[model samples]
Each structure stands twice: as structure tokens, then as C-alpha cells.
Target: MSATVFAGALFAGPVLAGPLRANANDVPLADIPALVLPALGETLIMVGIVMAVVVVVGVPLGAIIHNLARDGLFPNPSLHSALSWIVSVGRSLPFLILMVAIIPFTRLLTGTNIGIAAAVVPMSVAGIAFFTRIVENSLRSVPPSLVKVAKSSGGSSFQIIRTAQLGEAVPSLIGGLTINTIAMIEYSAIAGTIGAGGIGYVAITYGYQRFDNQVMLATIIILVALVAAVQVIGDALVRLTTPHSSTASDRRFARKVARLDIESANAASPV
Candidate 1:
């Protein structure tokens, strides 16, 4: 009898509990694209805005944090500690909890807390914290000898950082940017669950609540493809930026290669 009932439950999933098939509101598979595409665009816009903010703010902030350390160009223990603690606090909370926790702040800033604009606040906060660490780590991977050489050459602080530090770390930074962008895509979905509007909203409203298997499957496929495409593009960029071998000469050659690639790319591309 137990076996029979389990079989019945399995059957019920598609034949009974999935009453979406019986409902007048059931969406066809062909129409799933129509609904998901707009949501995808919204997700893209959300991630794009957050990434712009993350890059503009995260790079400088990461540089400041990195430079505050003992070995950094400028050491400030107090300021470093404060900033590190703040980033830690931001990283500690899960995105869902963070979203709820920052509702008042979001509303205060955006004057509302239920749209894409409202969602950008927490997303930017989380993205900035994550990308800042990525930038710091990438810069750390640069050889200290490079900085010394720059200083000996009479390079100014900003010049030393821009050339000896960030320039050498470009590949790692690109990889990190890819990871951060993917993360924001996920956050956009989470934001959608709370009515922030995106692919996540479609999944929640049509896929789960309505038990629409078609919409559920479509969203899953689209998300998988989107992520895969991003990963592929990111991996290619990383390869294009990375040195052929781990040697100073090889690194210089890689920079030349990257420069050529950059020249061919559209303007405003990352260095």
C-alpha cells in the first residue's frame, strides 16, 4: 500500500497537484520566451548598473584598503581596520537577510522598496564588498619587487599603483569581475522573489506558485544558458589577458597581446 501511494503521489505531481494544466491561466511553452525575455533584460540592467557602481567604487576602495596595510605604499592601521570591519559586516549577511535588513535604508534612498531601483542598493552593497576583496587579492598577487622598481624609477604613488600594481593584475581582476557579475545575476533573481522584478519574479509567480512546469523549465534553461555564456566569455577574456608562462618577460609579452586586443575592442574597455 505504501508503494502504491508513493506512485500515486508521483503521478499526482503532473496530473493533479499541477492544476495549472486545468487553469485558464496556464501559459504555453511557446509563450514562456515572451515572458522570460523582458525579465532577462531587467536582470541584465540590474546587474549592469550594480557592476558600474562596483567598478567605480570598488577599485579605488580596494586600492585604499590595500594601501593601508603595513607593506602598502601608505599605512594607516586605524582606517584599514575600520574599513575591513565594515566590509566584513557587509559580507556576513546572506543576500535575503540583507535585503530585508536594508529595507528602510533602501526606501529612504530610493523613496520606494519594491522595484529594480530599490533592489540596486543591497545588490551594490554586496557586490562592492565582494569585488573590493577580489581587487585587493589581485593586487596582492603583484610582486613587491615590481613596486620597489617603480619607486626606484621615481614613479609617483598614483603612477606606481596604476602601472606596477593594477596593470600587472589585470587578468586576475577580469576573472574576478566575471565572478562578481555572475553573483549579481543571482542576486537579481533573489531580489525578484521579493517583487523586485526580473527572471526571478517570473519563476516565482508562474513557475512555483502556479505550478507551471513549462515556465519553470524555461526559466531554468534560460538561466543555465545565460550563466554558461557568461562563463565562456569570461574564461576567454581571462585567457586573453593571462601570460603564456610565469616569467617577467612572458608577462610583458602578455601585456602587449592584451594591448592589441584592447585596441581592437570597443572603446571604454577595461585595461
Candidate 2:
């Protein structure tokens, strides 16, 4: 009776082990090239599109907001107040919640709620709002006296913004852009919840659902590398644009312009 029981137990062990081996991801290492390349491409595409839209729309929107506020070149308190409120509301929402809330809008724009195109809508919207605030803050950091110098020289509002404000703020703006771009990459991953095909989607479908830890780890590593590359490039650009002597000269010029602007304002006032 003992011998017979041992034989039955030995047979059952192999049978149970067979299913566990089969359940593990086959060719997980081999599948890396096939899966990661395409998913990485999709991620880049989504982030690229969202960033393009954000730069084109958000930069101008921020500039307009900056120029319209009090102490700006052309203050319009009511308009600035309204636009500021809109931006604040946009910036306050969490990205995931924003995605769900904009489903109807996304569907309207893309005609489908489950692909890269649809994902771009919410991503771009969020990117725009976030980057606009970054740009507004960057522009505000430019010495106010720069605007005064441009005005005293008879420079138009547009010229002052283009040549004085944005020109001076380029280094800070590039830093903001780098931060915004990284944020969009994160948003792209969240977008994968809706079947937007990117590394995130791959991680979810294959890594989490199928229990493939290899794939999940690979995706994470690739994302880290990509963000690091962006940061390096962004820092390089900022360094290239900001020369020390120019920055010092700018500070000096701003101080002189500020004193002159104050004197001119005092003389022009009706006491």
C-alpha cells in the first residue's frame, strides 16, 4: 500500500508542474524586440503630437495672459481675470479624471474612444494647460523693466513680446518645455488605460495580465532612458542659450530702464 501511494503522488507532481510551466510567458526574452520597438514608437508619436499642439497654442495663450495682467504692457483686468480663471480650472484637474471628464469631447473630436487619436485629445488639452502656466511664470520672471525699455523705444506690443519678453525668457522657457514634455510622457501612459497602444498598454496587457515581469521591467527601463535623454538635451540647450556676460548685462540694463521708467511715469502723472 505504501509503494502504490508513492507512485501516485509522483505522477501528480509532474502533472501539476506542467500547467505552471505552460502558464509562464513563453519567449519573453525573445519577444522584447518585437514588442518594445513598436510600443516605444507609439509612445513617441503620442508625446510628439501632444507637444506640438501645446507649443503652438499654449505659448501664445500664456503670452497673452501675461501681457494682459496688471503691471503688464497692456493690462486688461477683466479679460485677464476671465482667462486666468479658465487656466486655473484646467490646471487643477488630475490627468486621469480629466481623461474621463473629456470622454464626450474626445469622442466628438476623434470619433472613437479607444485609440491613439482619441488619447491625443485629452493629452494635448492637459499639456496645453500645464505648459501655459509654466510659460506665464517664466515670462513673469523677465525683468519688468525690459518691457519699459521696449515701450520707451516705441516698440509695439507684439515687437516687445517677441524681441524683449520671449527673447529674454528663452532659457527659462526651454526649461519649462523640458518639464512639460516629461509630463506629457506620463500622461501618454495614463492614456493607455483606454487601449491607447504604447509601452504602458503593453505593460498592462502582457506584464500585469499575463504575469510577464520581464516585459514590465523592460518597459520601465526604456521609459527611464527616454526621459533621461530628454533631460540631457534640454539642459544642453539651456546652457547654450544663456551666456554669463549677457545675463549680467541684461540685469544692469533692466535696472537702468526701471529707474528711467519710474521717473517718466512720475513726470507724466497729474498730481
lDDT for each residue of candidate 2 in 1-271, tens digit (9 for 90 to 100): 2332344456657555442232345435766779988999999999999999999999999999998999887899999999989989889999999999999999999999998999999999999999999999999999988888999999999999998899999999999999999998888888988889898788888766775656667888899999999999999888778876356667888899999999999999956
Reference-based lDDT, each prediction: 0.86, 0.86
Model 2 residue 5 distance off true place after TM-score fit, in angstroms? 33
Per-residue lDDT of 202 in model 2: 83
What would the per-residue lDDT of candidate 1 be over residues 98-211, giving only the tens digit for each residue?
999999999999999898999999999999999999999999999999999999999998999999999999888999999999999899989987798888889889888887
Question: What's model 2's overall lDDT?
Answer: 0.86
TM-score of each: 0.83, 0.81
